[model samples]
Target: MTFAPLDPVRLTADLIRCPSVTPAEGGALVLLQSVLKGAGFDCQRVDRNGIPNLFARWGEKGAAKTFGFNGHTDVVPVGDAAAWTHDPFGAEIVDGWLWGRGATDMKSGVAAFVAAAVDFVTQTPPDGAVILTITGDEEGAGRDGTRAILDWMEAQGEAMSVCLVGEPTCPDTLGDMMKIGRRGSMTGYFTAEGVQGHSAYPHRAKNPLHALVALLDRLTEWPLDGGTAHFDASTLQITTIDCGNPANNVIPARASATVNIRFNDAHTGNSLSDWLATHAEAVETETGVKIGLRCEISGESFVTPPGDFVALVADAVQAETGRRPDLSTSGGTSDARFVKNHCPVVEFGLVGRTMHQVDERVELAQIAALKAVYGRILARYFA
Candidate 1:
């Protein structure tokens, strides 16, 4: 079969046009399937709970030396539309930059890898499988996204030896950084209960707002950990504090506060949850108010360590851009956390300076360079 060179720039534009905000298919997956199927690849829709996903494979399933690429089609909300200088979904390229939501956060990353893989298999047709697992739910509640596909793969006995996640990892320039792992992410919610009363009669009511504030102070002010070898210090941030009572003259019956934590390998979600519960108890005892705590773990800290997979990707980045990429674990959680359980995984992609911002954009040249880097990784991996 004849295979045309995949164009990351054009592919990225088509993806951005879909408006596939979290949980929405936005036609992104369909476009990919069309091209993939035409290239003699086997494709399947791994949709779960209404969230769309695409699982495509070239060569035999469960084959040795299978190389996988993981990424998302869904992007975050466009935020305030009025502030943008370009159409959020226009996929317009101006002055060499492609402007649109998901341009960097990573529609472009997906394009680079897909393009590379298609060209590789059509031209070389690797002895092992090349798998692309893309999900439409990464920017939203991630439970039904990559995790769902892994579950399906497990049931079917499918596996990949090494997986590369195409998340934008470079902070300043392309080939500057690649993530070997990511910090864990979790959120804690606290609700303080008290009697409602008028502000003039302070003694008649317990102030739940005071209790909630105390709880937040305790959590935010206390440090979680100093730092790790490959990661920075774990930190907790107070995200929101709210009381529905708008009246200045009345004390609310209940007040709530939420905190988000980005933890390193020094802590686990279980340990942090226990710590939050203990602090909640202390706040309740000190403020004479009842408090309830709820917690959710988005993902846990994980690393692939420096190994063959890491070296393969880092060498590719260095070869393309002439700069050795830093092996980092500084970013927030990603789908790689889940993929780690299935196979050794690492992340490398274009520079992500404007992801999720109003005028999110990517340099057109970077997209092509990224495709080149990915192509090199594939060529060498299947050699």
Candidate 2:
């Protein structure tokens, strides 16, 4: 028996209409669950801490050669709704482009893969398994989205041999690049405290702002490294610094700053945190101001070395688009960082030039082509 092929463009439109903004289900998961469940997938609504996620599999619980696809249904907020050419949630198609918030950043990617997987299993069931882990918290704090599903998978003894994440990886065009790894991401918050006093008094009070500036200068003055083979040089960017003193003549009691680090494979979050602490301590000791440091790690750097798996994805992309995709590690972190702990994972999808922007959109042809590429990957993986 043969089932009708899934229509990714239409599915993408349906998803966009739901307005599943970050941390909200918005019926996006419900639409996906209904479709997957009807196509013989074991669907589960893995909700955690008020966030919605969906896990669906077509095979045994612990298949040895399971192929997984990860993506997010939730999208970033659509700022300045009136500034949009098309309704942010309308999912309207104009001039062969789909316009919406998640069009490229990536409700379209998810729709393509889900369509491909559903059609593949219905028409040519793979010898192994196919799992889809879709989360709703990727655009938000992300504490209980994919991580929650991973925890549930562990408790249930479910696993994947290799996974692919459908996050708009293409930089300029479809099939132009694929991510084999990602740089680690961490952020540091700094607080420096001192006594408040009149600015006219020379030595009456310590100025915390001066100490904060010195520490920030120390952190950014030196390069983290030359560069890694798969990544560029690590970077520490001072995102913000503030001294909340209203009076012009007052030396504020407290000054604060924040720095975000995108580090390569050479350092872990802990190592960088220690590095930050050392500099912070020095500033405090020299200036007689108390320094407080708080660090949060979004993800650690990870790479899936070039081999059979990388070649498999590359071959599929080249076969469909005739473009030899670059195996890159340059990008902001994704849920793949969490999945890396469970299985070797990579990311590929549509062009991301307009993701999270005011007029976010995706090319109609690329959406169809993305589905074809995903279909090819599934066919070869099972063969």
Candidate 3:
């Protein structure tokens, strides 16, 4: 039997009930597809390399401007379920808060946008188009999620005028802060190789540990960049160092360390990797040791400069909440980075205080307020 259409509160709870942990459908996409289809959206379940994603659009044919809502259906694994006051999948409401995994990290935002879409279709059928690009692989490697969908969209010649990612951007209150940009992230692994020898026989063998330490010192000795107007100063942090040698008298033949860099628009993954390679080579030459460097980038930094869409969203928030929102570029990487390639993307959502926590939750009032904000943005955008 078909369930009755759910409001934002019930919709959020319904989504949380699905347990769509990373790389798992968990029936979340099915539920979303059913709702969108019921609302007259042309729903297509796009699969890439065995990953589940959905693309739904509704409007008159030959529409010029398309406004899209993008989000992920995946939630981070609920660590230690017993630690939760309630079931992480229970979607319980107490003290005016709906509690569950993904409540704020994003199911709430998805529900808010879904409710907004429902409202939009009910009141005024779009003169253009309203689309959704929802993926189930966001919390994982992200190889087959938004990026793949974007490639598909590009091939189909579909263009979006503006896209909104509901990634829990608010720092203090709803609509208080909006993410206008994000820093890029890259991880590097370095290995220094040397001849194994007795620790006491210092004159006979090369010591890779010394070379590794010296290389790391050089890597972190200076900031990656000064703070940009829209982003903070870049930083490099060594997350791990390992030699795995237990013998007190034997020197390790090899040592490895992992470093992560959070950089601004001034750097890309290739550029940073080249920099590290050059530095590591310099150390290799000076110390007469072989050094290997490996790098992987999750995403590149991006900024949505002040534009028509940014102003439109900011104005909508102020008009609805009577408070001017701050435009921010502070956050980890999100699906917006992919959406940015297709159109202007901005992220504003529920307060992130409880996202990914044991008792993740959002206030009922805030859900309504977020819906209002989205509705206002829709009204303004379509105006």
Candidate 4:
């Protein structure tokens, strides 16, 4: 069968035209499904809880070897449309660059891999299968995005031996970096309750604000760890502190603060929760003030470690670009965190200097280069 080679840049431009904000289908997945289905791939609408997700497969299911690609079409809200020189949803090509919201955050990445997969299957027709898990909720709460697709795949006995997430992994250049793992992300919410009274009468009131500030100090002043081989030291950032009391002369009865932790393989979500709780308990014992703590773990730190699959991707990256890509876990959490649970997952793609920022764009050449790299990966993976 002869099929026209799908141009990734044109596909990316088409996707950028879709207004698929988080939690909205916005025709992005629809366009992909049409493209994939037209190319003899099996497609399914894996929408869950009203969040749109698409799952596509070529070749036999549960084959001896199945390579998968995961990406998201949903983009963060375009802030201040007037601040931009081009339409946020318009896939305008200016000076060898394609501009739009999802262009970098990852509509282009998706287009690259989709074009590669379609062309790979049509031309070479590998013995194994190819699966794509594209979600519409990566920029949102992420509850019903790839997680939901994985759940459905499990129930139906579908699986991918290894997955590559097409998130923007490079920092400065297209082939500079790739993620072998990501720091675990979790948020801790702390509330301190004490007696409320006038600020002038210090002895009459227990100030929760003071206790909360002191607790924050203990968490931030110290380092979580020196550093790991593939990961840096864990970081705890205080995102916010809230005390509703508006009166200048009153001590609030309750004050709360939130801290987020990006931890390394040295720790798990549970361990960090325990760490936060221990500090709150010590502060309570010392200050004689009641403290409440709650923690939510978005993802736990994980690494694929340098091995066979890692080499395949790194080799492909180096083959395309003259430089060897660094295998470092320096970014925030990604859908790869969830894919890690199912299979050996790695992240690789475009440079992400402007992701989620106004006038998000991708270099036209990088999009073409990324497709070639992915094409190389597929050829090597199924060789």
1-383 per-residue lDDT for model 3 (tens digits): 23343488888899999989988899999999998898888888888998899988888533787888999889999999999998999999998989899999788888888889877876776678888889998888999999888888887766677899988988887778988888999999999999889989967788899999999999988888898889999989999999999999998899999999999988888999999999999999999889999899988999999889899989988887777789998878898888888888998888899987888889999888888889888988888
TM-score of candidate 2 against the unseen true structure = 0.99
Q: Report the lDDT of model 2 for residue 351.
A: 90
Collision pairs in model 3: none
TM-score of 4: 0.99
RMSD for each model, in Å, please? 1.5, 0.8, 2.0, 0.8
Give stretches of model 4 more than 4 Å off: none
- Residue pair clashes in candidate 2: none
Q: What TM-score fits each model?
A: 0.96, 0.99, 0.97, 0.99
| Tens digit per residue, CA lDDT, model 2, 1-383 | 66899999999999999889988899999999999999999999999999999999998877778999999999999999999999999999999999999999889999999999999999998888999999999999889999999999999998989999999998887999999999999999999998899999949999999999999999988899988888999999999999877899999999999999999999999999999999999999999999999999999999999999999999999999999999999989999999999999999999999999999999989999999999999999989
Q: lDDT per prediction? A: 0.93, 0.95, 0.88, 0.95
The lowest-lDDT stretch of 10 consecutive residues in candidate 1 is 215-224
After superposition, which runs of candidate 2 have C-alpha atoms over 4 Å from their true positions? none
Q: Tens-digit lDDT track for model 1 on 1-22? A: 5767988899999999998999
Query: How accurate locally is residue 271 in candidate 3, as Cα lDDT from 0 to 100?
Result: 97
- In terms of lDDT, the poorest run of 10 residues in model 4 is 281-290
For candidate 3, which ten residues in a row score worst on lDDT?
1-10
| Steric clashes per prediction | 0, 0, 0, 0
